[model samples]
Target: MPVLSRFALLMLFCLSLVLVGGNSNELRAESRPNVLFIAVDDLRPELGCYGASHIQSPHIDQLAASGLLFNRAYCQQAVCSPSRTSLMTGLRPDSTKVYDLDTHFRKTVPDVVTLTQQFMKHGYKSIGMGKIYHGSLNDKASWDAYPTVRGRGYQLPETLAGIRERTKGLDVKKMNWRQRSKLTRGPATEMADVPDKQYRDGAIAEQAIKSLRELKQNQQPFFLAVGFLKPHLPFVAPQKYWDLYDRRQIKLAENRFPPENAPKFALTNWGELRNYSDMPAKGDLTDEQQLQLRHGYYACVSFTDANIGKVLDELQRLELDENTIVILWGDHGWKLGEHNGWCKHTNFENDTRVPLIIRAPGMQAQGKTSEALVEFVDIYPTLCDLAGLPLPAHLEGTSFKPLLSNPQRPWKPAAFSQYPRGRVMGYSMKTDRYRYTEWQDRKSGKVVDRELYDHRQDGAENDNIAGQPDQKRVVKQLSAQLKKNWKGAVVPD
Candidate 1:
């Protein structure tokens, strides 16, 4: 053949290969699902799907019905920053060196890719607002674009008259927003008769709705995260939400005192609660106070639920639900007088466990419930699997896609949680039937105290029976497992 004829044949062959490869890549991109992530702050599993029928959380219940709900999900640590950092980076608190609220994860793992950053890297438009990380704390490099002032989860304003009444002898009413935030608040609960947009969570929902609509018109797939603040501090909500429940019918925590044999440091003395003016600094809360506070929490939760519904409704209205994967989660659980603890600072079941629900576009186990033990750290790898992206080797969690497909599959042996008190670090591992905790000395790396709560008999974690002579063998097995799982250098003096 002539030279010109041979060259034309070779060019045709190369062109065919390029066309085939391009078509294959297009198919893979179309298969990738958009993500709609919702985070609620300080929420426990006291919802309609979790069997608390009295609670008015219809929005979350509808979400639960459309997905598989993990009955036992725990955060790496119960507090805000540590738990959020662990989930966002797929690292345990010890690994991230972010056990406290003040430290950022980048300080220890500066080059680590966050969950949102990984998605953004793969041609997704990632946007976030509200309480994704701890309030006023965020990963700047993660999102394509977010709000300048990530709004506080809740911001129901007190009337000037009300503020004056609360601060009769003071000039606090004249203070600016920054100055007022530093002032001591009077009530631990607020029932303001305001609209949803009047609060920060509601405004976040509005921004998220707008993003959803705009992203649908764009070519790139999107990751939209909307974090709701509610049922958290001050327990503020719209008065309509507060009216949903009768205060007389609300139930107080079954156990109001610390567990028997609980270590001195194991039980938090309700310090977070005492910061409020109305809450007592020394003695116990009155019966009326306890029930009233519980009512406020329930109301705020309902308020948050309603806002979530708004965002979900907008997604459907935009016809994006068919290709979107929805994941609703809380940072960690909260304690409403459980084991005499008012907030999440200890390794108790009430603080460590959280509510996690995931709904994929064509999921097999829709509306099912799973009792598998899973950790917050597992979320990063799971999203990667769902997005069909390459899993990073440095991640410390297992992909839970199998659980979404098979709710009863054999899963991890246990979920882990940790918290630090002044000089001690409590390492806790939650197995199928027990929570084993060992408080180690920060400097010496020696075990200072141990606690074992058997979920079978005491699901409320009402007692610590580690010292009981009868359960010595059980304690030994759990302690051995904790040592093997936690591979971290002990922080020193």
Candidate 2:
């Protein structure tokens, strides 16, 4: 054995050790679980998992089976921008100052980091497509790859022609989105004999599937946010989904009248639905129309469910399911003729309660349902805790990560929600047995209207007993608790 031969062999061994060290670093980075954040617009807790036997939500039901389903989850606001802003920023509507669709959260909190942005700061590749933010108000800085992919709302040529005819003389370019929407809106529901890709939700799912493949190739942990637009408005879905339900079997809301002895200001005109061509301008929806709308909503839910199944299938095929934290949440809830309302402008149970299903890797609470009162604002901190990241300083909500391990554990005492009605703000607090709302004047801060619905007696919220003589004590207690707001409602360590 020569001395020079031994020196050459030693040098090769040292170089090989350096290469293994670099590879180990890469492997450590990839060890972090990926996120599949799915957002569905205008979805309520009306599915098989939620005890709605009629709705066909197989894919969502499957996701519920694999995750801890929050049965009592409520959104901060019952609208798109505000609810999403609150959830993404981990701040309430008051903190973000985003109460309407037109106002962007960045306008008020310019330096605040969003949910995905927090993950991005921690070496996660954030990618978003479709309606993550409301309409065109997406934050480009939050996503490494953010693309807008949407198709026509109406697939029928006749519907398009009708819209053009309705807006023929008006200058659409000069109008804002709401004004343009009112003028050009067609029928409330459409069932087209087209493929799933023909609709925007289907296209979004396809893009998500493709993105999952690309992320797998890169071998980097990603935060993929896919938003689905359906069961929202103009309830247009593929013909096959519509065929899944029989119109005769579709039942309208049993309590179609307004809540007894409730304030007039508490109910919305539901102008959002009246803008549709088929809807009446100033009248109650006909029984036939109500049934049709319910049927349309169910079909759209099924359609969105199928699209979700596609993405989930792709994730499993890529073997990313085991290492991905899959979360499906609706931006807010929608009312289908509940309390004689058609939209989500009121702070009722139907409008504020949303569907939230989260399936994380190695969670022991599989197929469990938690009745814990959770709000959308808690989502940001929960994801952070689940991924082993520190909670942001600006987070106004507590993490519910503990509930994933012990689904039946006693959690937050109450969940808070709010809705703005002109100059009034209706702040609602839902405890285990009751929902109390105080409609206060925004400028003067005077509590003008009050509502108290006892869930033990009236689960449908068909009666308001705020002014009842026997319920005085109940109202007083709930009012005191409402004053505590989100801060006092935070879960204990």
Candidate 3:
């Protein structure tokens, strides 16, 4: 054998070793961070972080202070199913064809890959515990483990679950005329003297905390979505939470009526609030009743915040915070007697705008506030980008990774939201200082009504300027923008 041949063989062996070592290093550096996705139902921006200093939201405030809070975040629709469908699928409500609560997205687009399934495809274990989807529509295919979001939303003891049991019997038809006439109406707000675990949300928090502790032992990365059903209907919580707020100090809604000159169908029927047994059969709530409702909502918020704090505290205790990405988002805003409306289902600012906070590791965008216009759909691509996963081509939203590092980056000029009422669909666009909407007939696709609210002066959208002659030009411009190319298909320009 020649010495030159032996030396060549040795060099070849060294090159192979270097290649394997480099590949190993690359894989180690590219390990995706775990995701802690927390969702709150019907949460408005009435938090200390969102400039509501009087609200008791210390937990959410601290989370915002540790992350990048989007000042202008809008949901595709103001309702639960539609909004959650759009956010989870990375598609607009129109695209998903989920304009209402009854219809599932699969009925329209069966092959759609949801945000959770996207991560799961890349070897991550996805676990959904609460109201991540609307009702019992949680896609079983989208998770390694998905507990139905309704019945066991919490595992409260038999005693604490008594109030919920009563609500189950709210069907008026089931009661005889005598039963109905003799029915006793309880207040919409209830401060039960029960332990935290007595309510469903408290039970959800317990399960999530347990998950965090167990996840530390798993080798695979995780995407845990914990949904908190609070400040929602019934406004029920533990008595301790109700004690957190003073009913006297709670402020009633300023604009208790719909905006002046607004379209007739602009507000919902407020049927959700009306369905409660304590609510009167007709007319606006009394001043005292309004205050009680507001106080109940605040107490529910405080209860939710405390639960979130407990889960987040557990994460830190388990040392998961360092390598995990935490995202807190509300399904959509709620109008608590604002504009004479109760539940969400309108394009109004109080109904459409939502709270979104993302805290990525490495502290790139930590403790910052970004006023950039963003939408719920952006969560899909942004998570993909952060985790170094491939973005699906069908996603309608653009990744907001750039803005995560520099909050003032050039982002989307505006965010869009829409809601459906009967045969009419209201298309809304939110820009720097304006919220413009156009309601079109679903059958003919013809514009029926237009509304423009100048947020510069009235952020609460107290007045509709769309009908004013002086603001006609502004309305026209925004209308044109709304009807412009929405990713390819025109919204009937």
Candidate 4:
């Protein structure tokens, strides 16, 4: 062979060896399992799997069937920012010091490592989409790539016009998004004729699918967090989702009045719903209006369920289902006219209880339900435990990884949640039999009001029997447990 030609062939062989070596390294990184973390906004435990046959949530029900569904999961706080902050930071609301929507978790705990950030530190490619961290308060360091797609909250032209008319002479540019939204709000419900992709949740699903396909090509295990916004305020969804429910068949909440003998602060004014253009500011909704709101909420849920199905289908299509840990959770539960409340603000069962499902690869608890008490704060450590990563010392939650296998095993004694109303804080503890709450004055730390509902009888929370003569012993025991708080409730390792 000619000398120049021999040299060229030798150079090409060297380049091929380097390419093969790089590919091998990528394949090694793929040994760890991928994570598909799903977050849904304002979703309660209202679904077919949860025995709410009236709701058309086939996709969520299917997820529950495949995963281990928690029958009694609760959130740290029944609001967006605080609950999400607690879940992501593995801390309670009091620890995080974030009670309202405006305050960011990082403001209090700036150096804390979030759930996604912990995954990122372990060589997993973390990506977040949609409403993951409650509106625009995102942790930039937690993700490798976090892209956002903006869309109108309402779809119809009439709704857009109504908003414009409502805020005609106001300077919207000077107002923040929340303030502007309040001033230029449309009807509480909208059923528009549009494709699924036209909405934000639908668009988020498409983005997630695309990311999954791209991640399939890359050998790194990914932590893809997709958050869907739906079943929330000003319920807006495609007309087809609305068609899934017959309005006449939808019934109003059975217990529409406040709890008997309960403190006034325990009930909410549902100011979130009242801000809508069509809602009444200070009175009970008309029967027709209540039905419409229920119908809209159900439609929004079904719409979100369909979007979730699309993402899950894509994951299965890419053959990632076998090695991926899929977790679906709601940030917090919402009230559907229970106890004369329409939003999540109080520490009531309707507002605190959320739907949680976890489908880990090769888990023994597949297609099973766990009645164990779990809290949102436990999510951070549980994921860490599943990934074989060391738990952060700052984490305040217990890992319920053992329950994934033996779900019937004994777990935490109670799930704790709290809500702040002005100067008072209502701390609630939910055990197997009852939910007990104490409204304490923040300034002096004095128990001003108390609430207790025996779930065995008053599941709807129609009556507060805290002051009853016969339940003194029960209240005293629960009060002692409440004082113990989460630290006392944590299960042994």
The number of the candidate with the highest lDDT is: 2
Candidate 2 per-residue lDDT, tens place, 1-493, comes to 8999999998887765554342322223456789999999999999999999999999999999999999999999999999999999999998899999899888899999999998887778999998989986888888999876767789999999988988888889899988887887899999999989989898899899999999999866899999999999989999999999999898888877899989876798884888898988898888999889998999999999999999999999999999999999998888888787887977899989999999999999999999999999889988887886667799989888899999889889999999998899999999999999999999998999999999999999999999999999999889888997645395765
Predicted candidate 1 versus true structure: per-residue lDDT over 92-155, tens digit per residue: 9888989877788888999999999988777788999888988556888988988743333334
The window of 10 residues in a row where model 1 has the poorest summed lDDT is 19-28
Instruction: Give the winner by TM-score: 1 or 3.
Output: 1
Q: For model 4, how does the per-residue alpha-carbon lDDT over 71-182 read when each residue is reduced to its tens digit?
A: 8999999999999999999989998899987888878989999999987876789999998887768889878999876666789988888778878898998988689769
- Please give the distance, in angstroms, between residue 417's alpha carbon in candidate 2 and its true position after superposition: 0.4
Question: What is the RMSD of candidate 3?
Answer: 5.8
Residue 122, candidate 1: alpha-carbon lDDT: 71
Candidate 4 residue pairs in clash (backbone atoms < 3 Å): none
Alpha carbon deviation, residue 277, candidate 3 (Å): 0.7
Q: What's each prediction's TM-score?
A: 0.89, 0.93, 0.88, 0.92
- RMSD of every candidate to native, in Å, equals 5.3, 5.5, 5.8, 7.1
Comparing candidate 1 with candidate 2, which one achieves the higher lDDT? Answer: 2
TM-score of decoy 1: 0.89
TM-score for model 3?
0.88
Ranking by TM-score: 2, 4, 1, 3
Show the colliding residue pairs in model 2: none
